[model samples]
Target: MRYTLFFFLLLLSACLQAQYKINLQINAPKDSIAYLRGVVFDDKNYFPKDTIRIKKNVVILQSKKPIVGGMYYVQLDKSKQRFYFILENNDNLSLEIRGGEIHSNNPRNQVYFQYQKLAKSFEVIDSLYDAEVGRGRKFSYSDKAAFFKVKTAALAAFRKKALPKLNPSEVLHIYFSALNRLDASVPDKKNYAARLAFLKGLDFNTNKLLFIPTYKELVSEYMGYYPTQADSLLKGVDQILSRVNCQSKSYPYVLNYFVQLMRNRNVQNNTEGFVKFVNTYVEKSSCNALSATVKKTLIDDAARLNKVVNLAKSPAISLPDTTGVTQDLHQFAASFDYTLLAFYAPTCDHCQKEVPEMDSTMKLIESRLNLSLGRFYVCNEPGVPQATWRKFISDYKITTNAKHVELPSVSDIRTQYDAFSNPVFFLLNRAGEIVARRISPNTLRKYFAEIQRQRMAQNP
Candidate 1:
């Protein structure tokens, strides 16, 4: 009888561990569609985890499997507005979202939404200030004095009220949100700096929080807030590496985070940071600290990034143009006085807008001088459909005068050019050397104009 009772208890525990309940209610139009997206990594890339069809304006995301604790978003259709929440403890969690407001049983999400409400209120004050300026009226000191007083009081109240009661997980979410706040347009930098300093000193870098999706994000934003110069940036990377245990799983995760960040911005001397990081840490001792795959990726990415810094000879690539005829990039580029080597993707909305602007500007530049600018539009490796690419070209009315090539199978294309996003532009001279890389099309026009003026000055 004792042994049978023990087995029954064990089975009950197993059944309890295997299930989770997540409930969501959104006050939107009936029959609206909403998706529950899981946030992966600090980059906050969302993947659709579950879908809900709103019936009578409510849907329960019931699951028999345990839901992992992380950040998640509830997105409606294709709208820009998204409701974000943190899942903790993963038992009987409930969220009720109405319009832009979120109500939840979770205290962490409640504090987050409260803060959002305060921020929205502040935006109203900001719009009033903007309206004053728009009318060509001189902003009086009295106008902002009231706003500043209220803003200061409200922030102090919120921080004092919300922060002390939070668990480590909840505190980390607030820290992540605060770190990502825009500092460029803030009216009071001194007060903001103090808040940031307090946040930076928090006890966040623990082994327990390492697996949390927002952990590295907090660290990344904290590091980014400082380190305005290249040397400082290099030291910042070293500091992060030294802080985390190399044996821990977070070591490689954090390493990959910084590597990808630098890779995305790897143009001109910006590539120096990534190169130096690899060289410093690529020794057998340090390399052994990382997983085999991560070490290999670091070595391979460094090698490719090293080859294409400003003034480096462009790497040789063979790819078929939109016409299906294979062409050598280096040989073809040699024929033009300058080649605007653009790496883009069809799915990028920003690329969709910018490519046409580039086409228009280049057309205007072509008529001015014998310096014919050839457009080499290289589609980066994303496996976007050929039909989508063709449709994009037709929709944008992209110049048929350019060579359009899709290199989806070429893994080196991303590493070689550091094409982390679409609409990356590289300017190559007749000798197939990169003159300027990752600048806007308007900036490219100014660059060419400067060169033209300099040539006329030198020759005359």
Candidate 2:
């Protein structure tokens, strides 16, 4: 009898330490497919790990082993919409979806649902506030302002009280969500200085919160307000970086996010800010985890960017013109006040439409502005039939006024200009410096015309 009791106790402990089990049920039309996707940190896209088929409006998904603590989502294959949920090691949870909403027995999920609801309601109120300003009314929130004040205070109090009881994942979510509430509130009428100070005060140097995607968004939105003020913008970024310990995960996360943000926004006009950031944090960072490849890539990108931005002369291009005569871009047409270099491919659909419009616009503008135009057709010589290139020129009637060039080496051209897309243009002044780049031909024309007008006004 004693041996049997001991055996039973051992079996109970084994069961208690078993792998996580998840039971998910969906009440939908018959024969629906649900994809269970694994979550990636700071990425909105999900990759399916498993798929379950619904029969009689019921489908269950489970894990044979413990999953790493993070977020996961259930997506309907038919609708392609996803709903999020939290997962932790050895979590035995059940979720039910009905009437386009999810119900879960887990406390973490309950808190997430509550936050979502509150955020949705706050968005509605914020939209009304924006609508009033859209109609040209003074930016007065009136009753909404009072409501936001009370709501924000209550959220802060609730978060402070409830955060300790929640897990790290849930705490980060609720903390960021609560902080987001302050963004919608109306600022003081006489001064908005307090808002900037509040934004600067938020700490993002923790490693655990680094996994949350919203943290990057918060940093971006806060720093984006001072685009022209490079000093102010870098100051704001420096505040966040100051808290980041170089030895921690937050170092790479913050640095990489900063680089990607500048790249995406094309901060050429504010290159000083980019330069300052790289110098202060990137160069000075001696973190052991900072890999050599990443450092080299970052330095290389900054070098490439600096060369082509404003004062840097355009890279030299030596390719055969449409007539099979080789000519360098520097000597092709050196007399004009500005040269428009257009890079394109024959097979690109957007290029097909955009190239013609650009050709026509440049011709029209050249009749008035002192501008030169060159079209570089990027294609392999023998591989891409010469007939295709000739036909493109004939269709666009480009040869009547503009100089045409055919480039066989596509890789070198892409690297020199950092041309990621087709139909890229660069405007060079008479001195051969790149005065304007990555802008529409029409915008460049307007800018040139305005500059000429300003000059004439000064002379008159």
> Model 1: per-residue lDDT, tens digit, 1-460?
6457545644664566635456576787633778888665553544567877765444545545654466677878745467777665445667897776789886677777777678778887778778877785664334455656676567656766666676645534455444333221232223546435634543444543553455665565556544333355666676567667767645666777766655543222345666666778663444466767767787776676666654477777778877899977787788888888888888888898788878887777777766677888888746788889888888988864578888776477677777877888887888888887676765667676777899899999
**What TM-score does candidate 2 get on C-alpha atoms?**
0.64
TM-score of each model, in listed order = 0.53, 0.64
Supply candidate 1's per-residue lDDT for 205: 41
- Leading candidate by TM-score: 2
**C-alpha lDDT of residue 197 in model 2:** 59
Candidate 1 lDDT at 59 equals 50
Worst 10 residues of 2 by lDDT: 263-272
- Taken over the whole model, the C-alpha lDDT of each candidate is 0.66, 0.63
Q: How well does candidate 2 match the true structure, expressed as C-alpha RMSD?
A: 7.9
Which residue pairs clash in candidate 2? none
lDDT of 2: 0.63
